[model samples]
Structure formats: C-alpha cells, structure tokens
Target: MELDTPVLDDHMHLDPDHGRGIDAVEDFAHLGGTHLLVVNKPSWHLGVEAGDPDAVDPAAAGEEFREVFERTIKVVEAASDVLDGRAWPVLGVHPGLISRLVDERGFSPEDARDVMQAGIEVAAEYVADGEALALKSGRPHYEVSEAVWDASNEVMRRAFECGAEIGCAVQLHAEASEDMSEVAEWAEEAGLPAERVVKHYASGRLAGPIPSVMSEKERLRVAAESGEPFLMETDFVDDPDRPGAVLGPKTVPRRVRWLLEEGYEDAVRRAHVETPQSVYGIDTEATLSE
Candidate 1:
C-alpha cells in the first residue's frame, strides 16, 4: 500500500537485541511509517518473567530504569539515524512492576508509592529535558491480586500527577474491560487534561475522557464516527521469543492505508497527524517532511 501522508505508530517496544531492533525500525520505515514512539521494553526492568520485579533488588530498580532509559535513547537514536529523526521515546514504570515491588520486594504501600513516585519523577524530568515524548503507566487486569491492583492505581495516580506538573502526555496500558472513564477522571483530578491522556492498545467501541490507539478496522470505523480524535498503533513487541507478539511494526501504516483507501482519509489524517501533534506536541509536518 502506498501512503501519501506519513504514518505515526503511537506504541511499540525496542528489544535489546540490536539486530532485531534495527530491523524492526527499518521495516517500519520501508512500509511508509514516518514517525514512531518507541516505548521502553518491559523486560528492561521487569526481567524474564516480565512481571517479576522481585527478581531484582529494589535499589537496583532505579539503576535498571536508568539503564533502560539510556538504552532506549540509543535505540531511538539508531531509529532516527535510519528514519531521519522520526522516532521518539516514551519512558515510565509499568504498573505490574509496582505490584511486584509490593508483593515480592517487601515494600509496604507507602514504600512502593515512594519508589513509584521517584521513577515517575525521572520520567517527567526526561520529558521536561526533551529526552522523551511522554510517560507511560497502567495496571494489568489479569494475574494480579486485588491488593496489587489497588496499589498499582495509586502509583499510576502519582504518575498522572507528575505528568500534570511536567506537561507531558501519559499513555495507559490497562485492559479493555477496565473503565476508561474512571481513568480519565483520575487523570483530571491529577490536574492533567483528558485530551493529553492516551489509552494504549484500545478498540473503537471503548470511548472515554481521553483518546485511544485502535488497530482494528471496524474499531477504527466506530472511533471515526464519534468525531473524537484517535491514533493508530501495532504495539509491536520486538521480542525474539514472541516474534510479532501483538502486531507487526507495519500494521499501523497498513491500517492507515486501508482507511485512506476506504475513503476515511479525513479520519486517517485526524488520527495520524492532528491528534498526535496535539497530544505529544510533535510537529508532524516538520518531522515527517524532514
């Protein structure tokens, strides 16, 4: 599919495996994708289990985030080298990790909150310093205890507060069944604008206070009909063990091309150009034209 307008992938992860990481970005660009927001891979801090924050020392988690940030910077740099500065970074603490810290790392709710706050502060600093485009935080709805779920929300609340202070967007990774309206309300209470909050990996039917990144065709149609702005993403997790786990990096561009072909050109433009620019403060015209 040929796309006249450049595409933006709002959510993706770059694995530490350099070969696969480079290939992912290169393939995305080759498929007409111009801009990407590469989220820090979960394993960077969560380890092999991808949720076992207990495997690492609590003190080392801070260092782990630092390493992840530095490594993500390198990945974004390499992607920009290939895509001409179209790739950007989004850094934050995963909600699952917050629960693990409490369940496995012997952190009380208060202690976990402090650690979560500190991590979010660093993410906010990165945004303020122009190192990242946004901050990410969300709770997993499955395989987690109620206590952990509650604690995760508390931590995410703090993240929203930090985002409000630093003027950065917050990308959520919660489940489809979760109430997005509640999430948006909390973000508003934290002093962040509803439009600045993004629900990652969402479907068209789920509408809330903030916009969403939907990949399904039918969902895209539904979202477009609402007259609300949205974005597209593949949520590409570049893990060798689970190749194309969620979707391929080219999925968003392909979907956008399909939308264009279907005469939803205005919807495509609103999602890929206007919405992202408004949410992340990215100058799509300048970034893609470059």
Candidate 2:
C-alpha cells in the first residue's frame, strides 16, 4: 500500500449507515491509495426527509440539513484512521435534490433555491470551522424547468461566494460539457479563482474549473498528457446495491500504478503530487508522511 507519491481521489462518498463506508477506505489504502475528499451525500441518502414545500423557512432550512453535513464529517474523521494519508470532508447539498424539492416535495423553484443556498451557507460554516476542506455544489445535471434552472444557477453562485469567503475549494457535480465559460465567469465574479473550482466526475481536461477526472486508463492518459492542472477520482458512491458501480475504491491506486509502469512517471507525479497541492492547497507529502 506504500506509494512514493500520494494518490488522491479528489471526489468520493462513503455511506457508513447504508454502505461499505470505512471498509471502502481500507480497500483504497490496501491498494496504495493515500488520500480522499469524502463528499456529503444527498439529504435523503442520509435519512433527512424532504422539506415541506409549503413551509420553506429559510431560517430553519439549514437546520434541516445539519444532520447530513455532520454525519459526513463524522465519517471523514473516522475514515482518517483507516486511510494511509487522510480524509477531508467536503460538505454541501447535492444539486440533484432540486428536482425532488420541486416535483416530489411541491416546492416552488425559488423556495427550493433558497433552501439549497442556505444549505451551502451551513456547509461553508463547517469549512470555516476547519472541520471540512471544501464545499460541494452545482446545478442539476438533469432537465428541469427554466425557472428551476435559473434558481439552481443561483444556488451554485451562492456556493462560489461561500467558498470564496471561507477560502476553500468548491467541488462541482455538473453536467458533462467542455464549454464551461459560464461557470468560469461565475467563478471570476465570486472572486474564487477557476483553479480552485473542481469539476467532479469530469471525463477529460475542461475549460473552467480544474477537472477531477474519473480514473479510467484512457481518460487518465488523455488528461495527464494534456499537461493541465487536474486530479483523479473514482466517484465511487459505495452503494451496496450497485457494488463497485462507478468504479471501485481500489481503482485510483491501481490506475496510478498502471500509469507508473507505463513510464508515465512525470504524469503520475503531476496527478498525485503537484496538481492536488496546487488546487486544494494541501501538502500531499506532509499528509502521506503522517
């Protein structure tokens, strides 16, 4: 499990109450993977019921999300003991929940946005308190009404603002697209550099935010060879029903080893060492040594 450079999965999830949880971290550790950014799951996944659309109290909305974010931080703290490097929490409301708030919960688009923005503000509090390393937010990747879309964008902008104020990164679960000029513009307006904004589950090098590319061999090679600032991830949801669905916990380390064997030494170093430190502002060497 020892590696010369730290292998960081920039975006991942562990559902201790429902899935493999820390055992998944053990799997990664056993394969030479070192670090993780454990993102919070959606509220429903963490056992938070959908809010009453009729009572969209902006003041109480964050309290509704508190348990979900706290649980994610608890898991990350526990996971630090299992990982060879470290596990940092990335807390926020998942963007996909917007649809549920609107359609299933009967929330109007604006109310749903207010609820989500409040959740992001709560998440920023955790980062500000030093319990988490980053914030997670993005517009829905699925179709929605134009009003819902506009509201979702506002929520994302709020995330950017929170991240800027807290002086941390924001990991985005956005649609798969190369042209992210609009998002780049938003980052600029929020005063958080595009380099600190990561596109989670990205397929290749992207325009705006730094990409956290899925750790498949070909895609990894493309991103590495492009010589851009990027990171790698499994995007492993750790769902027992869909075991090893997106990619297994062992995927990142194994792929990094494969690239090392392929003589991509510099590429491996860029991905595992340099880029992560530059983007997340964490000391990879210091973390792995610990």
Q: Which candidate should be chosen as best, given TM-score against the real structure? A: 2
Residue range 92-201, candidate 1, lDDT tens digits: 87766655666676776556655665676777778889988899887775677666677778878887898899998999888774248888889999999888889888
Clashing pairs in 2: none
TM-score for candidate 2, residues paired by index: 0.97
Q: lDDT for every model? A: 0.76, 0.87
Q: Scored by Cα lDDT, where does model 2 land?
A: 0.87
* Cα misplacement distance, residue 126 of candidate 2 (Å): 0.3
What lDDT is obtained when candidate 1 is compared to the true structure? 0.76
* Count of clashes in candidate 2: 0
Clashes of 1: 0
Off by over 4 Å in 2: none
lDDT of 2 by residue, 7-77 (tens): 89888999998899999999998988889999988888877864667783843687788899888989998
